[model samples]
Target chain A: MSGQLTLYTYWRSSAAYRVRIGLALKGLEYASEPVHLVQDGGQQHAAAFAALNPQELVPVLRHGDQVLRQSLAILEYIDETWPKPALLPADAGGRARVRALAQAIACDVHPLNNLRVLQYLERELDVAAPAREAWVRHWIGSGLDAVEKLLAGDPGTGAFCHGDAPGLADCVLVPQLYNARRFGLDLAGWPVIARIDAACAALPAFAAAVPEAQPDGPRS
Target chain B: MSGQLTLYTYWRSSAAYRVRIGLALKGLEYASEPVHLVQDGGQQHAAAFAALNPQELVPVLRHGDQVLRQSLAILEYIDETWPKPALLPADAGGRARVRALAQAIACDVHPLNNLRVLQYLERELDVAAPAREAWVRHWIGSGLDAVEKLLAGDPGTGAFCHGDAPGLADCVLVPQLYNARRFGLDLAGWPVIARIDAACAALPAFAAAVPEAQPDGPRS
Candidate 1:
């Protein structure tokens, strides 16, 4: 059941970055095959990738012969297969709480602001640059604000989203906040999110998953 | 923990609809406290609703003091707490696969095509009405097509998304297809999705959760 572990990823893709954090946290290293999201209408849509993932998305994890897609699902698979340093709490309520927080970002925030959606707005809707930026800023600002409230208000928030240790919520949150920061959204309103992001940033798992840390991280 | 299960929901919100289906499937009745998404800039964002959910979106299940947001979280909570008519499988890989199929819709498809995102596209991007619909059709069609392929190609598909029983993935898929049909998106390509939707429709749990079946269901 063991073979070469390969991850199809793009450096700046938040979804890919989330999986990278999970893999690193599990301390399992895999071959990095970066799929450029922006070049050539996204190599993710190429025939080879479609053969791998009909959804034509990055962050497809190849574990031996079983290829998995979707960051949250892949995270669950990793947790199941590895079981160490449990990314989720043992209790059902605790797991529910963690998944809820993760979905607040994954299902609500990041999806609305993804690259393909933005490209659709530009090409199909003819959204001008400024308006597009405004659209990005508006959702990012609101979403981060909501996440901050979720973190600050919920007693579940400890040093991280659940307790003193990093979990699934952090895996999703850190990458999303990084994207928000990339768009230059005013994050001053989000003290709790900033604090949680800082907690995650201190860890090797999260630190290693940053966009700039990837093999094809943007050339500065 | 059982006093007055109030669901903060919208008439047409598929996420909310999923939770409604779960509640029905478990034979648990709840109060439908409508949070209108389009009227008054969304009642979900009101100061009162925000207190319960910082995300301020529909499908907030309030069971006494424990307020749960996110449909999947609520579904899992119900499943784990009640432990009857379980919404997940008995085994781990089966659970993972079911959850993966559910996430394929809840996180990937529904999130990208939700009301707020569509409104943003039109209001911010100046996307003409006709082109906006093309965008919707593109996402819903392709996303459902991917899901259909997953069901058709996998050995997993039986009477539902998992086996002879309806569970998390079916809970998610039914609502998404409801929304897709509401938008008049073409479903000609996804016979698998259509077949599953038909199977779900024959059941009382899903039927009762349809928009028309609710107290706040949109009047035809």
Candidate 2:
């Protein structure tokens, strides 16, 4: 909290949304620098932003001189440095469960349906719009189905993805559910996920972290 | 080290390979259960393996009754449970660096090129062989390019990704390098990655974890 904190983010990026939720959950304040992912061929690709993140991705958290990339890594850094409202569980097994759930979305679900991948489908692979949407829904459905199964069947799942309190897994799941709805995939079948999303949405942390609530969000 | 450790794995799975390296680095012994991903319509789809991992993926670690999925989470679990020869660095920033490097490969690179994704391109999208290879090479190339930049420009990189130790990043990088070679992408362009791979290969932990050395690896 002592250092000057800044977050390079896109309002609609699920990865960035995860970090936003993490920062909010930690009660940490930071300057928001919006990088439009689709404006004029992606502001993320601009020289300055690319220099900040070699991956040219958003949700890069800079604390004074320290710059951190990858949303999950950033979440962990926040948890480790701040050490309040722990994002992960105390026990190793529970920590593994939370991280596994988080990765299920972050690594498996989110990456496949990312802007860059969707753009590649359209531009490079010649995937038509309908087919592209189908592709997005397909991965999101399969991935969410797995997540639903994991959450629904596990006794560890409480008010959130892990236990009573929302944590890292919730940070990842809420944003993914947002993307899932954006792509028109119904969450009726994923009762557990829907319930967790509802629970997380009730919190101010998750509420403020939604893409629509961001500074760069569509002014409706 | 005392309790029975069981790993459900696939020979050529980069994710599974990562777990193997992690176990080897910790000098932990585990019984290997091979889940044939391609043979007999993928044993990973079998009910038993599905029960172990709802995602139906390989490298599920079972210790006693605790079952873990997702290779990265498993790596952290191993690191936390057995702190000897830490997979992550000690400092918070250093740990973030290692995790970011690991996720660059795990989340950004590998997930897009996984078996299910390629299968989707072929079965759902009807993308042909040359185009599929192009897709694979495209992602691997772009992903590794970012990795090369991260490693090459960072002063934190020593003999390995963090310092003079082979940790989580090396576990991820070696497996990814193996996958890149399998897809016929030349590694000559990435001097930093190649150098780190060479440094890691010289160690018994990594040497023993190579895909070709596994019990279920292709013979001859």
Candidate 3:
């Protein structure tokens, strides 16, 4: 937990935002080195960054010689190293529920609308800009709807994704909602997500980690 | 681990295949209550199944009162409860590496091409059958390409996703490859995955869990 944490991140990437919230929750300090996904023909594609992560993706957390790519993976490492504010639950069932919610977003929702996927839709599928936007909204909407069902239906869901205090699922959801709103996707259908996200944003960890508050946030 | 573990699964559902592999690895006995995903307008949509999983997805693992949804969640739960021949690595970094590889499949790849999304493409987007199949192949190809890059590029990858042992990453990769092969997507490009799948299938645990070998498999 004390090994000079360095996060290779993007200000606006939802996945990166998930890791930031996790670090703050665990009271871990890390230097944020931004990797602009779009700037200068994508810095992540550069040889320097590729050396750190062959996937050439951001939210690569480097602790000493160990480099962890994938935001969820980095978050898990942080949780294991610092177990004070546990990201997962105690019981196996509870942990499964929390992880299920996290994957509900991480797996089902975010990938369809990621910058790379969107770019692919345009370049490969020849989808029009407007249709591409619709595609984004479609996947996001269905994904969030499922999440809403998971959160709302389960009595286990408290103020956050699990038991009041923000945990792993909330770490994932808030950033996704940020992207959801940014894309102009209507969230009126997902009340549970709205309430949970509100609770998460109220927390300093989640608030400070918001993409709009980051160093690269739209320049005022 | 001793109780009746019922996996509500479809033979061809890769997500279910993941849990099947996990259960097999843990040497746990379970009932394969087939969910018939494509029959009678997707048996997963039946009122009875919907009550169990509101998400209307296959591969819900039922153990006593607890009904576990999501393949990764069930796999992790099985690992935690059993804790023998651990699916994840011993070290924090190693575990993160394995989980990341798994999520790279569970999160990034399979979700985009799952049953629901394909149904959506056909119904909502008016995509033709061939185009939908092409869509499946496209995502699978791109996703496997990314995964191949991750596994091959990482020096940590030994015989399995981590060291010489097959762990969580193999649990995810093997099933996804089943789906990929079922769809007739080319596997020649993904040597890392191809090699890993071969290793997994060689094991009794992974072998017993193959879709063709399942209770609900064709001719089963």
Ranking of models by TM-score: 2, 1, 3
- Over 4 Å off, model 3: B126-134
Q: After superposition, how far is residue A124 of candidate 1 from its true place, in Å?
A: 1.1
The sequence of per-residue lDDT tens digits that candidate 2 reaches over residues A1-220 is 4688899999999999999999999999999999999997999999999898999998899998999999999999999999888999999999999999999888898999888998999999999999999988888898998998898889999988898998999999998989888988888889988888888888999899888888999987
User: Which whole-number lDDT from 0 to 100 does residue A94 have in model 1?
Assistant: 82
Task: Kindly indicate the candidate among 2 and 3 with the higher lDDT.
Answer: 2
1 or 2, which is superior by TM-score?
A: 2
Task: Give the worst 10-residue stretch by lDDT in candidate 3 chain B.
Answer: B118-127
Q: Interface RMSD of the predictions, in order shown?
A: 1.6, 0.5, 1.7
lDDT of each: 0.85, 0.92, 0.84
Classify candidate 3 by CAPRI docking class: medium
Question: By DockQ, who's the top model here?
Answer: 2
Per-residue error for B162 in candidate 2, Å, reads 0.9
Error of 1 at A28 (Å): 1.6
Tell me which residue pairs clash in candidate 2. Answer: none
